[model samples]
Target: MLVVSLIAFVMFRFIGDPVDQMVGLETTLEERAKLREQLGLNEPLPIQFWHFVSKAAQGNLGISYQFKQPVAKLIGERLPATLELSFVSALIALLAGIPMGVYTALRRESILSKLFLTISLIGISLPTFLIGILLIFIFAVILQWLPSFGRGQVVDLGWWSTGFLTVSGLKALILPSITLGLFQMTLIMRLVRSEMLEVLRTDYIKFARARGLKNRVVNFGHALKNTLVPVITITGLQLGSIIAFAIITETVFQWPGMGLLFLQAVQDVDIPIMSAYLLMIAFLFVAINLIVDMLYVVVDPRIRIGGGEA
Candidate 1:
């Protein structure tokens, strides 16, 4: 968090002047100086960073120069959309990827398995923006099935709003979610296939087969279960990547999410929003890793037992 804060603060020095963005051509030098002073842009770099860090620790992310609203408030409004998109994307990846991986591993010689492998390769090879564009062309343009952009109609529930409650909202999510998740799905599929093949070759798997355990039991109950630890780690990291890199997909879809906001901040040099985004993303990465570590114990008792022994 500290490192991220430092980087974000340093951006203010080189990324154009906020005062220039805020002031008009008619503003006098004295007015610009006063505005700078008020915004603390006139202060020493170290002093400004210190103030930023101290206030951020207390949940005060400062106000955006562009929006003229609190950074936290802006983020809070956008966070749900990003999270919902990411959640649905991750769910699609796991639900489709895992089963396909298992089938491909078990039926490597089958034509259907070969076809799946080809599709997975395509998913991995296509860039996200291109995939999004293709989906829009097919579904929104030619087929005229789903809406091409926007969140549709969002329903507000007190402090939070969501798109899941509306028909248009769900349709709007399909293209973006598939675009964001395709690479992750391919990755998870490949990893699972490789892990399953390796696990099947192990002595324990052979022993289970010798013991006359059913193939389904030996494959899913044993091999699949053992594959989950590494899968959990990768999935956790990928979730963070999805959120951090959702900028491209959001831009392509014009989704009102944090990634889109961050892109706009970059264009306008809105330092407060940029800084808050970095800190929030870093915190999310840290939290996800911690959760992955905890999941290790739950998924594999061996990890807990080994730690206890150590």
Candidate 2:
């Protein structure tokens, strides 16, 4: 994470001063120099980066060049929306994927199974933005069933709300959640199908079948339970990816999340916010991976016994 943060910070040096972006062409070099000095741009790159790192340790991500507010504060305000979106999307993926996967895994050679798998393939193949646009066209523009953009009105949920929960808010959330979850849903379906197929062929599954256990018991009880360990591993990693990679979906839906903030920062050449976002994203990935690694021990004690955590 530190290495990635350092890289993110260093990349800005190559982009030149963001003050160049903010100042007018009529501005003199002397004026630019003064502005740079005011923004502490005259300092050595390493020194500036160290200062950023130091402030970041204290949850200060510096000031946004565009918003003119502290970057951390801005991110804090936007984060709950992103979290809500990611959480809802992952829930959709899991609920939709697992059952479909188990059902199809138990009947892989059927026509309906083939059709379902084909759709999952297409789901995995399409770009997320394209999916979002298609959804908007179908549900928002043509059908006029759901709103096309934004996070909608906030419902007061006391301590549990991001201020984005209401009848209108729930209505607006549908398309973006489906758009974000489709890829994960398809991926999870395939993983579950593959794992289930392999598990069904195992000796325990064969013995269960031979023992005259019901199909439901053998599939749901024995095979599904065994398949879950690997599926969980993928789900954990994919959930992390979903949170970090929601940037494109947020932009398509115009959702007021970190991704939208990053887009705005990019358009305005807001290097401080951009750099902070980059670092924050990398840190989340690292933190999620660590948590998932620890979960391996809890999920399957054999890993712990084998010293797999190192």
Candidate 3:
């Protein structure tokens, strides 16, 4: 994560000046120099990086030229929306993908299984932006079933509130969540099928079958339990990618989340905000992977003892 932050720091500082985006081209030379010094852009790269890391360690992520607020404050304001989208989307994927994967794995040679595999392949092939557009064309343009864009009306509920549960909000969420989660659903489906097949071939699974266990017990009780490790790993990693994809997804739908903020920040060369965003995401990925590693001990005790089987 430190290395990733370094890369983002070096890449962003060299791309363009935040001053250029904020100020007019006709500004006096002295004023431009003063502004550069004010933002610490006139410092050497190494010195700038040092200050950045030092300030960040102290919980100061610098200011955003776009919003004229601390980068942390802007991110905090937008984070709930992004979290809401990710939760809904991941819920849809896991609920739909797990069962679909189990059934298809159990009937790999059947026609229905083949059809599902083909559909999964197509879904994995399509990008989120294209999927968002198609959904909008169908639901927003043709059928008129849901809104095509925006985060809908803000629902106030005191400390922490989201508009997603309201009627209008639900309509607004449908397309973006589907758009964001389609790839994850297909990915989880494929991972589950592969893991289930491997588990069913193991000695324990075969022994359960030979012992006259019910088919459901042999499959779900033994095989599925064993198959969850990889599913959890991939799902954890895929959840990180969801944040990255949300940039494109939010841009397509105009949802007011971190992704949209990042997009706008990028366009306007908001270096402070961009650096904070990149660093935050890098930290999130590290934290999520650490959680996944810890979950392995709980899910499969054998893994805790250095054996692959539990």
Q: Which candidate is the best by TM-score?
A: 1
lDDT of 2 by residue, 29-124 (tens): 899889888877789988988876787888888788777899998887787888899989999999999988997999988988898899999999
Candidate 1 lDDT, 47-164, residue by residue in tens: 9889989999998998999999999999999999999999899999999899999999999999988998999999999999999999999999999999999888999988788999
* Best lDDT among the predictions, by candidate number: 1
- Candidate 2 clash pair list: none
**Positional deviation of residue 193's Cα in model 1 after best superposition, in angstroms:** 0.6
**Cα TM-score per model:** 0.96, 0.90, 0.92
Compared with the true structure, all predictions reach lDDT values of 0.91, 0.87, 0.86
CA error at residue 280 for candidate 3, angstroms: 1.7
**lDDT, candidate 1, at 49:** 87
Stretches of candidate 3 above 4 Å error?
156-161, 306-310
lDDT of 2 at 269: 80
